[model samples]
Target: MYRFSFFVALISYSTAINAQQIELRLHGCQTKSDKTYFCQLSNLGPIAIPAIEYNVTLAEDGRTFPWAEHRSGQEIAGGLEPGETMDLAIQLPTLPLRANEENVSISVELLPQYLPPPRPPADAPATAKTFANQVEACFNRSTLSSAAANGAIDVNVTGLKIQKVKNYVTDDAAAEQLFQAARRAILVCMSRNGTADVDVSLRFDGSGVHGLPSDY
Candidate 1:
């Protein structure tokens, strides 16, 4: 019954992963543009998950503003890949006036609708530095490059904290190769921003490709 035992072990392993929790993290909010709030969130665990569904709030002077509950009731997001960081913006009518005030704090709460998963480990660190624009551009370019063969690959890039770069793609080999191109883009883009030598982290789905680990 060697084959029967192997099949039993396989089922047990599948059960374990499905029972595993999807990890998430919400970084701090920083003032972006003129009175707008922006933040970064990441998938810190071993699995590549879908877009995060969240609601945001601004707290200061004893007042709070909720983004999803009160504004834009519906959700629209493409989820963060394993080790990928997703950039989010909080919208509010009074932000233009309130943003000027110092010590403003933002709170982003995840809703149950997306069956939002538990957060990252308590000891897991958080970062705020981002290359959202560059990420969007790079993903777009990579998708375009892969289009001829793989059609439009869906992915999101986040967590570009200085000296720490990471992203996730459907195809590790193609994405790793394509995102290396993204790394060069970051080099040029960051150089203009007065930074250099940012290390990168990449992850993919499955037990990973043969001879291809998640990090590079």
Candidate 2:
């Protein structure tokens, strides 16, 4: 009997060691006229959590009805780390009964998926024009198209656009090839300089690339 009890205790200890502890606290919630609620979800744990699964219910008139069941992870650029919080927009299905803020209840479960890899320290800040010039130089050296050289560059926080001064390569397929090459060059430049990622668009025609604002 003593041996059996020792084994049971060992098993219990192991289980406790492997168990994941998580907490969910709601800060504030707002209900819209269309049965949508904006709420806050917080992660109160020692480690990062990749995904959050939650069920929201409405308790009204002594009866409970399921409002929403949602799983979110990728909404956040990186996984939700310890002590981090995210905004959640939850919509409820229309029902004959009416529910208000006081009647809502939520239960959250944390999924222990793989943790995100550690990121390198950020590089020193540089102006958008400087980054754009570096990318243009890299593209000019990497591509075979002469028209790609000395292209006008526009860079913003989210996007980069390059327009050739002269359309030397008129073929659509050849222009696309140049664009692909330019894309690779931009990626390499970003890695070398430790710059943030941005979308790249190429214009073979002399016209400037549209859609990006000049004020940026």
Candidate 3:
């Protein structure tokens, strides 16, 4: 009977140790909108966990502040292993607490699911993955033409004369050409606006031009 009791006590101790082993920390929190708060949570342990269940509660009745309703949840993607942290950008949907209300303390709890060890970061190469594709799409006239052909960049022109220029910018030379063309158009518009020669020159940088008929 003594031996059995000793075994049960050992098991209880082990369970307590493991239960509190998982660490929980709040990275930061930001108010997104009157109704939403973006709470960022980070796991600062050296274990890759499959899932975590967390809860957050705010303090009530500080300085007689109005009661604010809060809803909390997680926006977790996959799991985090040891030495790797997970950033959960949670969007809390809640009604805004009135001003001059009580200061509130938020509480968070995390439950982690143990998984296999994490892979070394040295094996993963960080490169500009999207820039090349974006550049290629921008420079490929065929792609741009196809996109225009598909009405991706639709323009609804009514009164003004419309011109569609398809400039392929693959190399630096072509890019320079595109920039020059854009600059030339801007300069022409600026000259027209400054001299007031045109009836109406709308420079969209918060500038308006009223050209007199005799000024030109």
Residue-wise C-alpha lDDT for candidate 1, range 87-153, written one tens digit per residue = 7675633544434335444455643212222222233112112443433333334343321122112
Candidate with maximal TM-score: 2
Model 2: CA > 4 A from native: 1-17, 64-75, 97-216
Distance from true location, Cα of 91 in model 2, Å: 1.6
Q: Decide which is better by lDDT, 1 or 2.
A: 2
Query: Model 1: runs farther than 4 Å from truth?
Result: 1-18, 61-79, 93-100, 113-216
| Residue-level lDDT tens digits of model 3 in 1-216 | 000000000100012113323444555555544333444444555444444444444444444542333333333466554456445654432424453223443444443322222121232111212221222222323322211211111011112331222222212333344334333443453344442222221111001111111111
Model 1 scores what on Cα lDDT? 0.38
Cα TM-score per model:
0.34, 0.34, 0.33
Decide which is better by TM-score, 2 or 3: 2
In model 3, the clashing pairs are 46-82, 46-83, 47-81, 47-82, 48-80, 48-81, 48-82, 49-80, 62-102, 196-211
| lDDT tens per residue, model 2, 1-216 | 000000000000012114444454555566555455566767666666554434444434455545444544333557678899888666544433444545544433333232222221233233533555566555544344333332222223344444332222323344455556656666677777776555433222223222222332
